[model samples]
Target: MKYLVMVQGSQADYEAMRGNGSAQSPAWTEDEVKAMYAYMSAINDDLAETGELVDGQGLGEPAGTRHVTLGEDGKAVVTDGPYGETKELLAGYWVLDCASLERVTEIAERVIRCPQPAGAPVYPVVIRQIMEGAGDDVC
Candidate 1:
C-alpha cells in the first residue's frame, strides 16, 4: 500500500516563511532550518536506499495561496492570500510505499522528530492510505 505523510505546520511556521512575526511562537531560525534540512536529507537517503520513498518535497509559504469558490449566483468568486485562522497548513509530504499501516505510522514518528527549533513544539502529520485503482482486482 501507499501512504502519504503530510506535514502540517503551525501558524508560527507560516509567519517564519512569510517573514512576518509570530504572535505567540518564535520563528524558525537559520540554524533550525539547516538542521531540519539535514535531518530530512538523511531520512530521504535512507528511504531511497530502501526503495520505500516514492517522492516528497517541502512546500512554499502560504503567502501566495489563492482560493476560488462559486458564488450564490454560480459565478466564480476569487480571493487571495492566506485567509482566516489557518493554525496549520500543509508544509510538505512524503509518499511511501509500505506494507502496513503500522509501518507507515512508524515512519511518521521519525518524521515528526525531524530537527526544528530548540523550543518548538512537534507539529501533527496526517497519514492517509492510498486506495487501489478503481479498475483493479476486487479480490
Candidate 2:
C-alpha cells in the first residue's frame, strides 16, 4: 500500500532556520545546518535502499502560503498566510509504499527523528493510506 506520511510542526521553526525572526530563537550555526541536511540525507538513503520511499519534499513556510477557498457565489477567494488559530501545519511529507500498516508506521516513526530547531519538542507525523484510483470511469 501507498501511505503519505506528513510531518507536522510550527512554521516559525523554518523561519528560525533561515535566520529570519524569532527573538526567542537560538543562533542556528552553519555547522548545525549542514549536519541537519546530512542527517536527513542519511534517512532518505536508508529508505531508498529499502525501496520503501516513493517521493518526498519539504514545503515553504506558511508566510508564503496562499490559502484559497470557494465563496458562496462559486468564486475563488485568496488569502495570504501567517494564518491564525493553528500552531501545527504540514511542514513536509513522505510517500511510502510498504507492505503493511506496521511497516508504514515504522517509516513514520523514523521521520519523527529528523532535524528540528534547537531545543524543539518532538513533533507529530500523520500517516494516511492513499486510496486506489476510481475504477476506470472518466465521468
Candidate 3:
C-alpha cells in the first residue's frame, strides 16, 4: 500500500529553527544548509536501498500556502499565504510504498531521527495510508 508521511512542526519549534530566521533573520550559512542537505540525502539513500521510497523532496517554508473558504453568500473567498496557525504548519513529506502499516511506522521512526539544521529540533512525521480509488474519488 502507498503511504504519505507528512512532516509537521509546532510554532515554537519552527521558531527555534536556526539557519534562517523567519523573515526576521538572515539566510542559513553555507555550512548549515550543506549539513541539512547531506542528512536528507543520506536518508533518501537509505530509503531507496530499502525499496520503500516512492518519491520525496524537501519543501520550502510554509509561507506560500493559500486558503480558500466560503463566505456567507457562498462565494469562494481566497486568502493568500498560510492561513492557519503556524503551530500546525506542514513542513515536508515523503510518499512510500510499504509492505504494511507496521513497516511504514518503522520507516517513520527512522525518518524522525534524521538530522536537522543546528538548533532545529527534529520534526514529527505522520503516516497515513492512501486508499485505492477511482479518479479523484477515494474508496
lDDT of 3 by residue, 78-129 (tens): 8876445454667778899889999889878877776554455555689888
Superposition TM-score, candidate 3 onto the true structure: 0.74
TM-score of 1: 0.85
TM-scores of the candidates in the order shown: 0.85, 0.83, 0.74
lDDT (tens digit, per residue) of candidate 2 on 1-139? 8888888656667766776546544445667668777887887888899998899888878788788999999999998987867777887888888899999887777767776566654677899888768446556
**Ranking of models by lDDT:** 1, 2, 3
Query: What's the CA error at residue 135 for candidate 2, in Å?
Result: 8.2
Clashes of each: 0, 0, 0
List candidate 2 segments past 4 Å from native: 20-27, 134-139
Q: Each candidate: what lDDT?
A: 0.79, 0.77, 0.70
Q: Lowest lDDT 10-mer window, candidate 1? A: 17-26
Each model's Cα RMSD: 3.5, 2.6, 3.8
Alpha-carbon error at 45 in model 3, in Å? 2.3
Q: Compared with the true structure, what per-residue lDDT tens digits does model 1 show for residues 26-126?
A: 67766777888899999899889989999999887666667899999999999876756776678899999998899889889999888765556567889
Best by lDDT: 1
Model 3 lDDT-worst window of ten = 10-19
